[model samples]
Target: MLMNPRVLVIIPAFNEASNIESTVRAVVDAGYDYIVINDGSKDSTLDICRLNGINVLDLSQNLGIGGAVQAGHKYARHYGYDIDVQVDGDGQHDPKFIPLLVDEIVNGADLAIGSRFLSSTDGFKSTYLRRVGIKWLSFWLQLFTGRSIKDPTSGFRASGCRAIKLFCENYPDDYPEPESIATSLKAGLTVSEVPVRMRERQGGVSSIGGFSSVYYMIKVSLAISIACLTKRS
Candidate 1:
Protein backbone atom coordinates (compact mmCIF):
# COMPACT_ATOMS: atom_id res chain seq x y z
CA MET A 1 0.00 0.00 0.00
CA LEU A 2 1.12 3.51 -0.74
CA MET A 3 2.14 5.57 2.28
CA ASN A 4 0.00 8.50 3.37
CA PRO A 5 -2.26 8.97 0.37
CA ARG A 6 -4.07 12.30 0.32
CA VAL A 7 -7.79 11.69 0.82
CA LEU A 8 -10.79 13.98 0.48
CA VAL A 9 -14.27 13.35 1.80
CA ILE A 10 -17.10 14.29 -0.54
CA ILE A 11 -20.52 14.98 0.95
CA PRO A 12 -23.37 15.42 -1.51
CA ALA A 13 -26.57 16.91 -0.21
CA PHE A 14 -29.93 18.07 -1.51
CA ASN A 15 -32.56 19.40 0.88
CA GLU A 16 -30.66 18.11 3.88
CA ALA A 17 -30.34 21.29 5.89
CA SER A 18 -31.38 19.56 9.09
CA ASN A 19 -28.66 16.91 8.93
CA ILE A 20 -25.87 18.34 6.81
CA GLU A 21 -24.27 20.25 9.63
CA SER A 22 -23.87 17.27 11.92
CA THR A 23 -22.71 15.11 9.05
CA VAL A 24 -20.02 17.55 8.01
CA ARG A 25 -19.02 18.04 11.63
CA ALA A 26 -18.54 14.31 12.06
CA VAL A 27 -16.27 14.16 9.02
CA VAL A 28 -14.35 17.17 10.26
CA ASP A 29 -13.98 15.63 13.68
CA ALA A 30 -12.61 12.55 12.00
CA GLY A 31 -9.80 14.76 10.68
CA TYR A 32 -10.39 14.31 6.98
CA ASP A 33 -10.43 17.05 4.36
CA TYR A 34 -13.96 17.42 3.05
CA ILE A 35 -16.10 19.30 0.56
CA VAL A 36 -19.87 19.53 0.65
CA ILE A 37 -21.69 19.76 -2.68
CA ASN A 38 -24.92 21.55 -2.00
CA ASP A 39 -27.05 20.26 -4.83
CA GLY A 40 -29.28 23.27 -5.22
CA SER A 41 -31.00 22.49 -1.97
CA LYS A 42 -34.26 24.37 -1.74
CA ASP A 43 -33.68 24.26 2.01
CA SER A 44 -31.07 26.25 3.91
CA THR A 45 -28.41 23.60 3.54
CA LEU A 46 -26.04 25.96 1.78
CA ASP A 47 -26.62 28.61 4.40
CA ILE A 48 -25.94 26.11 7.17
CA CYS A 49 -22.65 25.08 5.56
CA ARG A 50 -21.61 28.69 5.04
CA LEU A 51 -22.63 29.61 8.57
CA ASN A 52 -20.56 26.75 9.94
CA GLY A 53 -17.61 27.68 7.76
CA ILE A 54 -17.68 24.31 6.03
CA ASN A 55 -16.03 23.90 2.65
CA VAL A 56 -18.88 23.79 0.16
CA LEU A 57 -19.57 23.82 -3.57
CA ASP A 58 -22.96 25.37 -4.23
CA LEU A 59 -24.76 24.24 -7.36
CA SER A 60 -27.01 26.69 -9.13
CA GLN A 61 -29.56 23.94 -9.77
CA ASN A 62 -30.24 20.58 -8.22
CA LEU A 63 -28.57 17.79 -10.16
CA GLY A 64 -29.55 14.90 -7.95
CA ILE A 65 -27.10 12.73 -6.00
CA GLY A 66 -25.17 11.54 -9.02
CA GLY A 67 -24.34 15.01 -10.25
CA ALA A 68 -23.48 16.25 -6.81
CA VAL A 69 -21.08 13.36 -6.20
CA GLN A 70 -19.55 13.66 -9.66
CA ALA A 71 -18.88 17.33 -8.91
CA GLY A 72 -17.03 16.21 -5.80
CA HIS A 73 -14.95 13.73 -7.77
CA LYS A 74 -14.05 16.49 -10.18
CA TYR A 75 -12.98 18.66 -7.28
CA ALA A 76 -10.88 15.84 -5.82
CA ARG A 77 -9.27 15.20 -9.16
CA HIS A 78 -8.49 18.86 -9.73
CA TYR A 79 -6.96 19.19 -6.29
CA GLY A 80 -4.81 16.10 -7.02
CA TYR A 81 -6.17 13.96 -4.27
CA ASP A 82 -5.12 10.32 -4.32
CA ILE A 83 -8.37 9.03 -2.89
CA ASP A 84 -11.97 10.23 -2.46
CA VAL A 85 -14.46 9.02 0.09
CA GLN A 86 -18.21 9.69 -0.18
CA VAL A 87 -20.29 10.18 2.94
CA ASP A 88 -24.01 10.82 2.68
CA GLY A 89 -25.39 14.12 3.97
CA ASP A 90 -28.37 12.60 5.77
CA GLY A 91 -26.11 11.18 8.53
CA GLN A 92 -26.96 7.57 7.69
CA HIS A 93 -23.31 6.92 6.92
CA ASP A 94 -20.88 7.18 9.81
CA PRO A 95 -17.58 8.94 9.28
CA LYS A 96 -15.69 6.71 11.71
CA PHE A 97 -15.69 3.85 9.21
CA ILE A 98 -14.10 6.13 6.63
CA PRO A 99 -10.62 4.95 7.52
CA LEU A 100 -11.58 1.36 6.86
CA LEU A 101 -12.84 2.26 3.39
CA VAL A 102 -9.71 4.29 2.71
CA ASP A 103 -7.56 1.47 3.95
CA GLU A 104 -9.13 -0.84 1.39
CA ILE A 105 -8.36 1.69 -1.32
CA VAL A 106 -4.79 2.04 -0.15
CA ASN A 107 -4.50 -1.75 -0.28
CA GLY A 108 -5.32 -1.62 -4.03
CA ALA A 109 -9.08 -1.68 -4.20
CA ASP A 110 -10.29 0.71 -6.88
CA LEU A 111 -13.62 1.05 -5.10
CA ALA A 112 -14.16 0.04 -1.50
CA ILE A 113 -17.78 0.07 -0.32
CA GLY A 114 -18.92 0.27 3.28
CA SER A 115 -21.48 -2.55 3.41
CA ARG A 116 -23.90 -2.80 6.32
CA PHE A 117 -24.88 -6.33 5.33
CA LEU A 118 -21.28 -7.37 5.67
CA SER A 119 -21.87 -7.00 9.38
CA SER A 120 -24.11 -9.60 10.98
CA THR A 121 -25.24 -7.25 13.73
CA ASP A 122 -25.73 -3.62 14.79
CA GLY A 123 -26.72 -1.39 11.90
CA PHE A 124 -29.74 0.26 10.37
CA LYS A 125 -30.54 -2.21 7.62
CA SER A 126 -33.26 -0.08 6.10
CA THR A 127 -36.82 -1.38 5.56
CA TYR A 128 -37.56 -4.91 4.52
CA LEU A 129 -38.81 -3.76 1.16
CA ARG A 130 -35.70 -1.74 0.61
CA ARG A 131 -33.54 -4.66 1.61
CA VAL A 132 -35.39 -6.86 -0.83
CA GLY A 133 -34.87 -4.32 -3.56
CA ILE A 134 -31.21 -4.07 -2.72
CA LYS A 135 -30.88 -7.86 -2.87
CA TRP A 136 -32.45 -8.06 -6.31
CA LEU A 137 -30.10 -5.41 -7.57
CA SER A 138 -27.21 -7.20 -5.96
CA PHE A 139 -28.08 -10.42 -7.75
CA TRP A 140 -28.17 -8.72 -11.12
CA LEU A 141 -24.98 -6.82 -10.45
CA GLN A 142 -23.17 -10.00 -9.53
CA LEU A 143 -24.46 -11.74 -12.62
CA PHE A 144 -23.12 -8.98 -14.82
CA THR A 145 -19.89 -8.13 -13.04
CA GLY A 146 -19.07 -11.59 -11.69
CA ARG A 147 -18.48 -9.98 -8.32
CA SER A 148 -20.48 -10.28 -5.13
CA ILE A 149 -21.19 -7.01 -3.29
CA LYS A 150 -23.56 -7.27 -0.37
CA ASP A 151 -24.48 -3.61 -0.31
CA PRO A 152 -24.54 -2.40 -3.85
CA THR A 153 -26.78 0.50 -2.84
CA SER A 154 -24.36 1.79 -0.24
CA GLY A 155 -23.31 5.45 -0.57
CA PHE A 156 -20.53 5.12 1.97
CA ARG A 157 -17.64 4.23 -0.27
CA ALA A 158 -14.03 5.10 -1.07
CA SER A 159 -12.53 5.42 -4.52
CA GLY A 160 -8.94 5.18 -5.65
CA CYS A 161 -7.42 7.19 -8.48
CA ARG A 162 -8.82 4.94 -11.23
CA ALA A 163 -12.37 4.97 -9.93
CA ILE A 164 -12.19 8.69 -9.20
CA LYS A 165 -11.17 9.50 -12.75
CA LEU A 166 -13.87 7.21 -14.15
CA PHE A 167 -16.60 8.82 -12.05
CA CYS A 168 -15.36 12.34 -12.76
CA GLU A 169 -15.68 11.73 -16.47
CA ASN A 170 -18.92 9.70 -16.61
CA TYR A 171 -21.28 9.19 -13.71
CA PRO A 172 -24.92 8.25 -13.66
CA ASP A 173 -27.33 11.05 -12.67
CA ASP A 174 -30.49 9.23 -11.55
CA TYR A 175 -30.44 6.88 -8.57
CA PRO A 176 -26.72 6.38 -9.01
CA GLU A 177 -25.50 4.40 -6.03
CA PRO A 178 -26.22 0.95 -7.38
CA GLU A 179 -25.58 1.77 -11.01
CA SER A 180 -22.20 3.25 -10.30
CA ILE A 181 -21.01 -0.11 -9.02
CA ALA A 182 -21.79 -1.68 -12.37
CA THR A 183 -19.93 1.11 -14.12
CA SER A 184 -16.91 0.61 -11.91
CA LEU A 185 -16.77 -3.13 -12.51
CA LYS A 186 -17.36 -2.71 -16.24
CA ALA A 187 -14.30 -0.51 -16.39
CA GLY A 188 -12.25 -3.37 -14.88
CA LEU A 189 -11.90 -1.67 -11.52
CA THR A 190 -11.42 -3.76 -8.40
CA VAL A 191 -14.42 -3.45 -6.09
CA SER A 192 -14.41 -4.62 -2.48
CA GLU A 193 -16.55 -4.18 0.61
CA VAL A 194 -15.90 -3.81 4.32
CA PRO A 195 -18.31 -4.20 7.22
CA VAL A 196 -19.61 -0.94 8.67
CA ARG A 197 -22.32 0.05 11.11
CA MET A 198 -24.69 2.82 10.08
CA ARG A 199 -27.35 4.71 11.96
CA GLU A 200 -30.77 5.77 10.81
CA ARG A 201 -31.02 9.20 9.28
CA GLN A 202 -30.55 11.87 11.95
CA GLY A 203 -33.04 14.23 10.26
CA GLY A 204 -34.70 15.07 6.99
CA VAL A 205 -36.44 12.57 4.71
CA SER A 206 -34.70 10.03 2.57
CA SER A 207 -34.77 10.78 -1.14
CA ILE A 208 -35.98 7.23 -1.68
CA GLY A 209 -39.07 6.67 0.42
CA GLY A 210 -42.65 5.45 0.14
CA PHE A 211 -43.81 4.77 -3.40
CA SER A 212 -40.59 6.15 -4.82
CA SER A 213 -38.91 3.08 -3.38
CA VAL A 214 -40.51 1.07 -6.10
CA TYR A 215 -39.34 3.53 -8.70
CA TYR A 216 -35.87 3.45 -7.20
CA MET A 217 -35.67 -0.31 -7.56
CA ILE A 218 -36.82 -0.36 -11.14
CA LYS A 219 -34.81 2.64 -12.22
CA VAL A 220 -31.60 1.45 -10.63
CA SER A 221 -32.04 -2.09 -11.96
CA LEU A 222 -32.51 -0.74 -15.46
CA ALA A 223 -29.56 1.57 -15.11
CA ILE A 224 -27.36 -1.28 -14.00
CA SER A 225 -28.48 -3.40 -16.93
CA ILE A 226 -27.72 -0.62 -19.36
CA ALA A 227 -24.37 0.00 -17.76
CA CYS A 228 -23.47 -3.66 -18.27
CA LEU A 229 -24.20 -3.42 -21.98
CA THR A 230 -22.35 -0.19 -22.63
CA LYS A 231 -18.83 -0.66 -23.94
CA ARG A 232 -16.13 1.21 -22.15
CA SER A 233 -13.62 3.17 -24.20
Candidate 2:
Protein backbone atom coordinates (compact mmCIF):
# COMPACT_ATOMS: atom_id res chain seq x y z
CA MET A 1 0.00 0.00 0.00
CA LEU A 2 1.21 3.52 -0.82
CA MET A 3 1.75 5.88 2.11
CA ASN A 4 -0.93 8.52 2.56
CA PRO A 5 -1.88 9.23 -1.04
CA ARG A 6 -2.86 12.89 -0.55
CA VAL A 7 -3.65 13.37 -4.20
CA LEU A 8 -5.73 10.72 -5.96
CA VAL A 9 -5.34 10.79 -9.73
CA ILE A 10 -8.47 9.57 -11.48
CA ILE A 11 -8.12 8.42 -15.11
CA PRO A 12 -11.49 7.70 -16.69
CA ALA A 13 -10.37 5.55 -19.58
CA PHE A 14 -12.61 4.18 -22.30
CA ASN A 15 -10.69 1.93 -24.70
CA GLU A 16 -7.31 3.47 -23.94
CA ALA A 17 -5.22 0.34 -24.54
CA SER A 18 -2.47 2.21 -26.35
CA ASN A 19 -1.94 4.83 -23.66
CA ILE A 20 -3.26 3.48 -20.33
CA GLU A 21 -0.06 1.72 -19.31
CA SER A 22 2.13 4.70 -20.07
CA THR A 23 -0.26 7.04 -18.30
CA VAL A 24 -0.41 4.83 -15.23
CA ARG A 25 3.39 4.61 -15.20
CA ALA A 26 3.66 8.36 -15.40
CA VAL A 27 1.31 8.76 -12.45
CA VAL A 28 3.35 6.24 -10.50
CA ASP A 29 6.55 8.00 -11.49
CA ALA A 30 5.03 11.21 -10.23
CA GLY A 31 4.60 9.48 -6.87
CA TYR A 32 0.88 10.05 -6.41
CA ASP A 33 -1.80 7.43 -5.80
CA TYR A 34 -4.03 6.91 -8.83
CA ILE A 35 -7.19 5.03 -9.69
CA VAL A 36 -7.89 4.07 -13.30
CA ILE A 37 -11.68 3.91 -13.73
CA ASN A 38 -12.14 1.53 -16.61
CA ASP A 39 -15.52 2.45 -18.04
CA GLY A 40 -16.36 -0.92 -19.56
CA SER A 41 -13.73 -0.69 -22.25
CA LYS A 42 -13.88 -3.59 -24.71
CA ASP A 43 -10.22 -3.25 -25.62
CA SER A 44 -7.20 -4.34 -23.54
CA THR A 45 -7.53 -1.30 -21.29
CA LEU A 46 -8.56 -3.16 -18.14
CA ASP A 47 -6.10 -5.97 -18.82
CA ILE A 48 -3.26 -3.51 -19.24
CA CYS A 49 -4.18 -1.75 -15.98
CA ARG A 50 -4.38 -5.06 -14.11
CA LEU A 51 -1.06 -6.22 -15.53
CA ASN A 52 0.60 -3.07 -14.33
CA GLY A 53 -0.86 -3.45 -10.80
CA ILE A 54 -2.34 -0.02 -10.96
CA ASN A 55 -5.21 0.89 -8.63
CA VAL A 56 -8.38 0.48 -10.66
CA LEU A 57 -12.19 0.76 -10.40
CA ASP A 58 -14.17 -1.23 -12.96
CA LEU A 59 -17.78 -0.60 -14.05
CA SER A 60 -20.10 -3.32 -15.32
CA GLN A 61 -21.55 -0.97 -17.94
CA ASN A 62 -20.20 2.12 -19.62
CA LEU A 63 -21.29 5.13 -17.53
CA GLY A 64 -19.95 7.89 -19.71
CA ILE A 65 -17.56 10.61 -18.48
CA GLY A 66 -19.45 11.75 -15.41
CA GLY A 67 -20.10 8.27 -14.04
CA ALA A 68 -16.48 7.21 -14.46
CA VAL A 69 -15.31 10.32 -12.63
CA GLN A 70 -17.88 9.87 -9.84
CA ALA A 71 -16.64 6.33 -9.28
CA GLY A 72 -13.17 7.71 -8.71
CA HIS A 73 -14.50 10.24 -6.21
CA LYS A 74 -16.30 7.55 -4.22
CA TYR A 75 -13.17 5.43 -4.17
CA ALA A 76 -11.08 8.34 -3.03
CA ARG A 77 -13.52 9.17 -0.25
CA HIS A 78 -13.63 5.56 0.90
CA TYR A 79 -9.83 5.42 0.96
CA GLY A 80 -9.43 8.87 2.63
CA TYR A 81 -7.50 10.68 -0.07
CA ASP A 82 -7.54 14.45 0.36
CA ILE A 83 -7.39 15.49 -3.27
CA ASP A 84 -8.55 14.21 -6.68
CA VAL A 85 -6.70 15.08 -9.89
CA GLN A 86 -8.56 14.15 -13.05
CA VAL A 87 -6.36 13.27 -16.02
CA ASP A 88 -7.81 12.16 -19.33
CA GLY A 89 -7.10 8.66 -20.67
CA ASP A 90 -6.01 9.60 -24.20
CA GLY A 91 -2.80 11.34 -23.01
CA GLN A 92 -4.09 14.84 -23.59
CA HIS A 93 -3.06 15.93 -20.07
CA ASP A 94 0.62 15.92 -19.13
CA PRO A 95 1.58 14.14 -15.92
CA LYS A 96 4.52 16.49 -15.30
CA PHE A 97 2.17 19.28 -14.20
CA ILE A 98 0.65 17.24 -11.38
CA PRO A 99 2.81 18.83 -8.71
CA LEU A 100 1.92 22.37 -9.69
CA LEU A 101 -1.75 21.58 -9.29
CA VAL A 102 -1.24 19.69 -6.04
CA ASP A 103 0.85 22.45 -4.56
CA GLU A 104 -1.84 24.97 -5.35
CA ILE A 105 -4.46 22.78 -3.70
CA VAL A 106 -2.30 22.19 -0.62
CA ASN A 107 -1.86 25.92 -0.31
CA GLY A 108 -5.66 26.21 0.11
CA ALA A 109 -7.47 26.21 -3.22
CA ASP A 110 -10.27 23.67 -3.37
CA LEU A 111 -9.67 23.16 -7.09
CA ALA A 112 -6.65 23.76 -9.31
CA ILE A 113 -7.59 23.93 -12.95
CA GLY A 114 -4.79 23.45 -15.50
CA SER A 115 -5.55 26.07 -18.11
CA ARG A 116 -3.90 26.01 -21.54
CA PHE A 117 -4.83 29.65 -22.13
CA LEU A 118 -3.31 31.17 -18.97
CA SER A 119 0.33 31.18 -20.07
CA SER A 120 2.20 32.23 -23.18
CA THR A 121 3.54 28.72 -23.84
CA ASP A 122 0.22 26.86 -23.90
CA GLY A 123 -2.22 26.35 -26.80
CA PHE A 124 -5.72 25.08 -27.67
CA LYS A 125 -6.90 23.17 -30.76
CA SER A 126 -10.38 22.30 -32.12
CA THR A 127 -13.09 23.53 -34.49
CA TYR A 128 -14.52 27.03 -34.50
CA LEU A 129 -17.71 25.88 -32.82
CA ARG A 130 -15.85 24.32 -29.94
CA ARG A 131 -13.75 27.44 -29.45
CA VAL A 132 -16.92 29.49 -29.60
CA GLY A 133 -18.53 27.15 -27.14
CA ILE A 134 -15.71 27.53 -24.61
CA LYS A 135 -15.83 31.29 -24.92
CA TRP A 136 -19.62 31.48 -24.69
CA LEU A 137 -19.90 29.49 -21.47
CA SER A 138 -16.81 31.16 -20.07
CA PHE A 139 -18.58 34.49 -20.33
CA TRP A 140 -21.50 33.34 -18.21
CA LEU A 141 -19.20 31.52 -15.82
CA GLN A 142 -17.26 34.69 -15.08
CA LEU A 143 -20.47 36.62 -14.59
CA PHE A 144 -21.76 34.06 -12.15
CA THR A 145 -18.52 33.63 -10.19
CA GLY A 146 -17.08 37.15 -10.41
CA ARG A 147 -13.78 35.58 -11.41
CA SER A 148 -12.38 35.08 -14.88
CA ILE A 149 -11.58 31.41 -15.42
CA LYS A 150 -8.67 30.91 -17.78
CA ASP A 151 -9.95 27.51 -18.86
CA PRO A 152 -13.44 26.48 -17.90
CA THR A 153 -13.64 23.16 -19.72
CA SER A 154 -10.18 21.65 -19.23
CA GLY A 155 -10.25 18.09 -17.87
CA PHE A 156 -6.88 18.65 -16.19
CA ARG A 157 -8.26 19.81 -12.85
CA ALA A 158 -7.61 18.90 -9.21
CA SER A 159 -10.39 18.89 -6.62
CA GLY A 160 -10.26 18.52 -2.86
CA CYS A 161 -12.62 16.50 -0.64
CA ARG A 162 -15.06 19.39 -0.18
CA ALA A 163 -15.44 19.83 -3.89
CA ILE A 164 -15.40 16.11 -4.60
CA LYS A 165 -18.29 15.62 -2.18
CA LEU A 166 -20.33 18.13 -4.11
CA PHE A 167 -19.60 16.41 -7.42
CA CYS A 168 -20.28 12.85 -6.33
CA GLU A 169 -23.53 13.92 -4.76
CA ASN A 170 -25.02 15.89 -7.67
CA TYR A 171 -22.73 16.03 -10.69
CA PRO A 172 -24.04 16.45 -14.19
CA ASP A 173 -24.20 13.13 -16.03
CA ASP A 174 -22.47 14.33 -19.25
CA TYR A 175 -19.85 16.95 -20.14
CA PRO A 176 -19.25 17.49 -16.45
CA GLU A 177 -15.81 19.04 -16.03
CA PRO A 178 -16.92 22.47 -17.20
CA GLU A 179 -20.16 22.39 -15.30
CA SER A 180 -18.39 21.20 -12.16
CA ILE A 181 -16.13 24.24 -12.20
CA ALA A 182 -19.15 26.50 -11.89
CA THR A 183 -20.65 24.33 -9.21
CA SER A 184 -17.37 24.41 -7.31
CA LEU A 185 -17.30 28.20 -7.38
CA LYS A 186 -20.93 28.68 -6.42
CA ALA A 187 -20.54 26.29 -3.53
CA GLY A 188 -17.84 28.64 -2.16
CA LEU A 189 -14.85 26.57 -3.15
CA THR A 190 -11.67 28.39 -4.01
CA VAL A 191 -10.80 27.67 -7.66
CA SER A 192 -7.62 28.64 -9.48
CA GLU A 193 -6.16 27.88 -12.91
CA VAL A 194 -2.49 27.34 -13.75
CA PRO A 195 -0.72 27.05 -17.09
CA VAL A 196 -0.39 23.55 -18.53
CA ARG A 197 0.38 21.92 -21.90
CA MET A 198 -1.59 19.17 -23.63
CA ARG A 199 -0.43 16.23 -25.72
CA GLU A 200 -2.15 14.65 -28.74
CA ARG A 201 -3.97 11.33 -28.39
CA GLN A 202 -2.14 7.99 -28.69
CA GLY A 203 -4.78 5.49 -29.89
CA GLY A 204 -8.25 5.15 -31.36
CA VAL A 205 -9.94 8.03 -33.09
CA SER A 206 -12.10 10.01 -30.66
CA SER A 207 -15.68 8.79 -30.39
CA ILE A 208 -16.48 12.36 -31.40
CA GLY A 209 -14.14 12.41 -34.40
CA GLY A 210 -16.67 12.69 -37.23
CA PHE A 211 -19.95 14.62 -37.42
CA SER A 212 -20.44 13.64 -33.81
CA SER A 213 -18.03 16.45 -32.92
CA VAL A 214 -20.65 19.00 -33.88
CA TYR A 215 -23.33 17.18 -31.95
CA TYR A 216 -21.07 16.94 -28.90
CA MET A 217 -20.39 20.64 -29.01
CA ILE A 218 -24.08 21.46 -29.17
CA LYS A 219 -25.10 19.01 -26.47
CA VAL A 220 -22.37 19.90 -23.99
CA SER A 221 -22.81 23.61 -24.55
CA LEU A 222 -26.51 23.36 -23.82
CA ALA A 223 -25.94 21.11 -20.83
CA ILE A 224 -23.50 23.61 -19.36
CA SER A 225 -25.87 26.54 -19.82
CA ILE A 226 -28.86 24.74 -18.38
CA ALA A 227 -26.94 23.34 -15.43
CA CYS A 228 -25.66 26.82 -14.64
CA LEU A 229 -29.17 28.26 -14.51
CA THR A 230 -30.41 25.67 -12.04
CA LYS A 231 -27.35 25.73 -9.75
CA ARG A 232 -27.46 27.96 -6.68
CA SER A 233 -25.27 31.06 -6.60
- After superposition, the stretches of candidate 2 with alpha carbons farther than 4 Å from their true spots are 1-5, 122-129, 231-233
- For model 2, what is the error of residue 187's alpha carbon versus the real structure, in angstroms, after optimal superposition? 1.5
Each prediction's number of clashing residue pairs: 0, 0
Provide the overall lDDT of each model, using Cα atoms, as 2-decimal numbers: 0.92, 0.81
Clash-forming residue pairs, model 2:
none
Error of 1 at 47 (Å): 1.0
Q: Give every collision pair in model 1.
A: none
The positional error of residue 24 in candidate 1, measured at the CA in angstroms, is 1.2
In angstroms, give how far residue 27 of model 2 lies from its true place: 0.8
- Give the lDDT of residue 213 in candidate 1: 84
Number of the predicted model whose TM-score against the real structure is largest: 1
**TM-scores, one per candidate:** 0.97, 0.89
